[model samples]
Target chain A: MEHLLPLAAALPLVAAALLPAVAWRRPDAAWGWAVAVGAGLLGIVGLLLRRLLQDGPFSYAVGGWAPPWGIELRFDALSAFSLGIALVGVAVLVFSGRYAQAAVPPQRRAWYYSLLLVNLGGLVGFACAADLFNLFVCMELVSVSSYALVAAGGGRIAALAAFKYLVAGAVSSLLVLFAVGILHALTGSLNMADVALRLADVEARGPVLLALGALTAGFMVKAALFPLHLWLPDAHASAPSPVSAVLSALVVKLGVLGLARVLPLFAGLDWLVLAPLHEGLAWLGAIAIVAGALAALLQEDLKLMLAYSTVSNIGYIVLGLGLATPLAMTGGLVHVFYHALIKATLFLAAGAIIHQAGFRTLRDLRGVGRAMPWTGVALSLGVLAIVGLPPTAGFLGKWYLLLGALEAGRPGFAVALLAGALLIFVYYLRILNAFYFRAPLREQILAVREAPLSMLLPVMALALLCLLGGLFGSGPVALAALAAARLAGGG
Target chain B: MRRLLTALALAIVGAVMLAGLAGLPRPGDPAAPVHTHVAAHIVAHGVEDTGSRNLVTAVLLAYRAYDTFGEVVVIFAALAAVMVVLAPAAAPPPGKTAPPPSPAPAVAPSPVVGFVIRLLAPFIAAFAALVLWHGEALPGGGFQAGVILGALLVLLSVVMGRGLEQPLVPAAAARWLQAAGPLAFAAAMLIGLAGAGAVLGLPAEPAWGRHAVLLLLELGIGLGGAAIILGLYLQMRGH
Candidate 1:
């Protein structure tokens, strides 16, 4: 199972490379192949996760070369996020079967699934990477695949959005690569653990600060934290729904996770005061929460609203990290997992409605709930979860965040968090009202049927997970706390 | 005012970056960590450990093969991206055609130019092969050879006026060729596991084993890179 660490990331990529060839004669076969690969990935992740639970954590040095000389892949508590990635990956792939048949052209379908697999492979690799250069490489794989996935559905607006995303992604990737290079120069090792050890002896505070600053900024942009989030809404909203789910649920978290990974690198440096950075992050996160929800409230398009909600949710995670309390960081990490499930549920359910009814806006999709009850119930569960309603996955993270804010004696931030939640609730209320209460503004919505089992199954499973994530929240919360302890250097 | 603000932001960022870079060790300083740490190790043991005369190839394919594998996938993804964005809508019925978005060169290639390219083609191919074959012992390697071959193909296509409508390689074979980089890496990974007991580990016993693995990677990367470049060219040409 420990040996499976590298295979977990490699299998998806190898399968992806073979997909177009295998499906060349019959493009329809691409869907089955992608789902099977995705399921295989899930199975591998399950084995790794079980191993992680039993043994604590494990590392694999590729090519039998030891760390600092060879690339190291670590499956630690922090990397437990691979479970979420694989889960969402399989769901999204299963969901894409029906969605792509409608949304993507037959000729482009194989490439579409191929890119998604590459994106998933990259995300898993990024989570497990312990080497600085390896992290950057996996990040590039994810970024390139994501930019293309945005334009995969193919339209002028999507092309334009993809270009915007490309510019932002390219700049961020360069920043990360630049920092990696600097770290290598400073420490003479590309391994993160080795660099952290060596960084303490380095005399150049300027370069150290610069590297830290560059990494934070780059990852923040990738995570789409506010102010740096200009490219996210257009890109996420315009992408094909499955791509949107992957980007919103898993890809953006890369930045937050990247921050978590690199923060500990500079933790041992005495001259570097992370307090100022934390303070700034907390303030910005507070602003993003209010601003993102307000922005979501104004959007008529369902996908657009979901995209903005992602920005707001990212704020909650960042705020939790910024608070720098064990509880807070734990909350943030837990949200990272839960948000992936909840957002994926929302996007896929919303995707089903839009695909079936041909209506994307709230007003256009009015009374869609009655027409598609299961998907509507799933979307509602997702909506309730996202709003931080009680006993839902969303609530636990926010509750922890609120307690963390108070625990840190920052009532002002606590107020901001509560206020943001209220704003989210009000906006989500509008969705519920529109979805369940209003008369059908578009008659075709009445004729729309329940989403097919392929799409419905993934959405329902995710929605159920969103609920289970809350009810059985202790497991993930414990896992997150373990990760948080390590990030805080307590372990 | 907006332009001035933009310039101000750019200048500030540039100044900060420059300041940070200023703190780095002086270039080519032998005592710097970059030289003293991993580089020193590679310099000392690279040849014996990896059995490549050229240290760079040793580093790329042996010590840090995973990163190289990642890079190969990145290139593959680039081609996938291009095709996803630019591929024509579901295959047109046989014998039906949409006019090319951009017209072919208005004038034909000069006879002399074509003749010169035709004369140079075989020599270029031979040179590419040499570069690839000798890469383990020299500075030239897979990526460089790939660029050379890809450029030659692009040049021939230009002189021949072969639009994507009639690709130099058939579409079916082209897909596999474009995927050759990752496919080769996958094969190497399994071979490494069987012979070397690790994924991507090169076997040591048969003096020729490591060389065979290296050559396989070189061919895959070289061919795959060239195929992808041509595919990109043909796609962007908008037939």
Candidate 2:
């Protein structure tokens, strides 16, 4: 079981490598293989999570070399995020069956599934990576695959958007690699724990601060936080829908998780003050909240609206992290988990509707809810969840964050949170209004049918999880609080 | 003025980074933490522990083998990425299993140039084999040998012209070979588990088990890298 740690990530990757060859004779076999691999991953992660719950936290030294010498994969509170990765990975892969069949070119389907698995494997590997260099490697795996996935559906806009994303992603990746090199040179260790321990003894603050700055900037761009989010909307909007779900739900969250992982490295230094950094993060996060929501409100394209909303929701998570209290961090972490579920549901449902009706804009999609009632209900549920209505997944994160703000004696931040939520509510209401209430701007919308079972099942399943995640929210909140405690405790 | 501001910003960033780097311990100073800590241990035990005479291979294949596995996947992913974006456009029409027709070269290579390439190819192949075979004792390793082999294939493709679009390797075989890096790692992992009790741990009883695993990895990386490089070249050359 302990050896199963590496297998959690490796299984998907090896399966992915085999996918194209396996599907070569029968192209459609790719979907089944991918979904099986995804389910296998989910099972592996489940067992690991169970072990994590039984034991406190565990570490696996790769190739039997003890850490500070060889790479380590730690299944700590932070790594529990692999569960979310696996869960959403399975959902997204299942959703991709019909979605890819329709949207992706027939010749590209196997490669598309292959890229998706690599992306999931990278995300899982990243969450469990206890070595800085391993994190960088896993990140590259995710980043490269993501860029290609955007263009996998191949149109001029997708290609252009992918190129733009590639540039931004490359810059961020370079920054991260530079910082990793600097840290390695500074401390002579690539292991995160070893680096942190050695960093405490180092006298020079200059290099440490530089590495921290680089790491923060790099991860912020990866997270698509605020001003750095310029590449996200176009890339997300232009991508095939299932790819959009994976990107918006899981990929961007790695950036925030990266921040959480690295912030502890600097926590022990006496000369370094993280307060100014936190203050800046808080301010940027607040502004992003308002700005992203406002941008979402302005978008007429349905997927583009969801993409901008992703930017705004990321603001909520970042703001929680910025507040820098255990409660605030818990809020942030919980949101990270719940938001993955909510956003995946939203994107997949939107994909189904668009795939069915062949119209993408709000006006064009008007009354689509009435036509495709089941998918519309799921989308509406997603809308409610995203808007933070009570007893829904989205509400808990924002609620905890608002309380965290007041707990930290920051009423201003609390007000900003409310204002952002209100803005989000307004945009989401527009989606509901267009989707359900308004007369069809296009007459053909009335004739559109519900999405096929393959597409519909995954969307409905995710939407149910979105509701259950809130109803059974205490379990995740408790786990998040535990993670927050560990984070708040200085390394 | 905007350009000036851009330059100014870059200069500022460069200066700060330089200042930070200057604070680093001087390179090759034995007193530096890099030299004294993990590096010291690797230098001491790497050979004995891993059974590779080349300490570089020892570290790469033994102590930090998992990272090597990741790197292999990264290379594989690179190929996967290229294929996903470009393969569809370059693919043969549906229901056709035959290779896509390559547009004829505008000017055929000079027979003398072609002859020279063909003449040099065998030696290049031998050199690649030597690099891979001697990786345990020499500076050259799988990636280096891979680049050599990949370059050889590309050179041959250029000279061979029309018939070479399918290249030396068949399409079906090329797919498997392109995955050789990761597939080899997976094989090594299972072998290690059976023989050594750890996921990538080389066995102690056989004494040759470690060597076999290392050689297998080298071949995988070398062959896999060559295939992927060729695939990228062919795909990007377009239909």
Candidate 3:
């Protein structure tokens, strides 16, 4: 079982080596190799999560050296976040099979598969890393892969978008490196727990606070939070559908996880105060929710709208994080998973539409529901779940977040939360109305049919997970509660 | 107006960050926590524990080897990305699976440059191998050696006045070679499991097994780094 710890990173890497070789002789086998790696990863991540839940949180010291001297990877209830991420990786690889054949050029399939597996390994390692420097390396791994993944769809716009995303990500990464340098100078420890322990009486309040600020700003850009999110919609929209799904579903969340990993260092410490930071995050989140939803309402491109909606959804999670109560933390963590499920469904369904019918804008996709009913149904369920209808997986995160907001005595945030939900409903109605009520604007809509089983299975599975995530919300809620308890208790 | 707004926003951010920076401790305090704790231990004992006279190599290969493994993978990902983006825009139409056409037109090598490369290649190879061998004891290590070798290879290709995908090192072989660093580290991780039960950990006794593992891993990094750097150059130039 301990061996499984390092294998999470090693397996995909070994696959990364083998993938291009497989791609050389049998371009067809590349996808199979990626799926095999993802399946192996799925089992490993699932076992890690189960073991963590059963035995409580555990930490592995890499290379048999204990920490303060070596790196560590820790798994707690919070790692449930990655269990879901790993599942999404598996589903997306499976989904990309038939979808990539049409959307990506034949020559590029192996490269795409290689990038996807490497990206997955990066995410898994990022979630598990407890060493600050290790976290930086892992963050870079995901960011670099995503920058290229964004460009994989192959168009002038995609190249431009990838470059933009690269610039933003590079700044974020540099800031993280700077912060790590400051922390290292202050504590001489790269192991997070070790640093936290050494910094108990940090004398120079200014540098510590400055480092925290740098880190927060860096992660904010990566997370696409509010003003820092300028690169997101374009990067997410222009990217191929499966790539978009991964970007929206998994990539940004790693930024949030990076923040979660670091914030614990200064939780109750005096040199770096956290109260004001949380307060700032709440207002930032409130603005993001309203601003993102309003912007989403005006988008013409279907994928662009979904991308902006991701911005709005990210706000909910951040707001919950800002609320800072145990319940709010639970909501934020749970939303992290539920949103991944819903957004992946929405984007994959949208990808199917684009692949089959060649439409991108809402106006162009009018009456697509009648032509591709299965994709439409999955899209409708995803829209329902995202709009926070009861008994959907999406509802649980919002419910906890709203309750946390109200309980924390921030009724204004609760109002903002509600208003954001209502605003989201209006735009989702626009999508549904176009799907069901609007007349078919083009002859191509009549020729469209259900997506292939490979793509559709993952779409439907995620939609069902959303429905069941809500129906069986108790499991996630309990897990999230436990995670929140672990976080609050540790810091 | 937009420019003014942008300026105003930038000013506000600068102000906030300045406020935060105002609070940091003075740099390099001799009595700081860093000097008191982790740094003291590593400087005092790291060499003894990891058997590498170079503290950086010791830390990189033994104590924090897992991070180095991840670092190598990140490099591989960057190479893969460059390959994907530069994939010949005019690849044979889907379903055709034709052999890749010859690389973009090769630049003719000047006689002086070819003569220089011919003279330098052997020395560079010897020096790179020397660095890889002595990495555990000296400042030179896998990355430096890899760069030296990789530069020589690329230089050779340019001087030969040919595309990179020759029979000597085909595209498939290049990809595998580029990944050699991570593959080596992965092998080390498995070998490491035999000793420490923890991934990438060396045995407490700092002797033969450890040195053997270190040499294997360093050679892997040296070779991997050279392959990837050359591969990246070829991808950009060839495409």
- TM-score-based ranking, best first? 2, 1, 3
lDDT of 1 by residue, A1-491 (tens): 46688888999998888899899988889999999999999999999999888888899989888888888999998899999999999999999999998899877899999999999999999999999999999999999999999999989999999999999999999999999999999989999999999999999888898999999999999999999999999999999999999999999999999999998999988888888999999988999999999999999999999999999999999999999899998998999999999999999999999999998999999999999999999999999999898899998899999989999999999998999899999999999999899999988988999999999999999999998888999978988999988988822
lDDT of 3 by residue, A97-205 (tens): 9988876777677888899988888888888888999999888889999999998868999999999999999999999998998888777788888888767767767
RMSD of 2: 1.3
Candidate 3 residues lying further than 4 Å off, grouped into runs, are: B1-30, B93-107, B165-168, B203-206
Separately for all candidates shown, the number of backbone clashes (residues 3 or more apart, or on different chains) is 0, 0, 6
The per-model DockQ list reads 0.75, 0.69, 0.63
* iRMSD, all candidates: 1.1, 1.5, 2.0
Best by DockQ: 1
lDDT of each: 0.92, 0.90, 0.85
CA shift of B228, model 1, Å: 0.6
Superposition TM-score, candidate 3 onto the true structure: 0.95
- Model 2: per-residue Cα lDDT over A222-301, one tens digit each: 99999999999999999999999999999999899999999989998988989899888988899999999999999999
User: Which scores higher on lDDT, 1 or 2?
Assistant: 1
Off by over 4 Å in 1: B90-103
- Model 2 chain B: which ten-residue window has the lowest total lDDT? B161-170
Instruction: Give the CAPRI rating of model 2.
Output: medium
Task: Give the chain A TM-score for each candidate.
Answer: 0.99, 0.99, 0.98
RMSD of each: 1.5, 1.3, 2.3
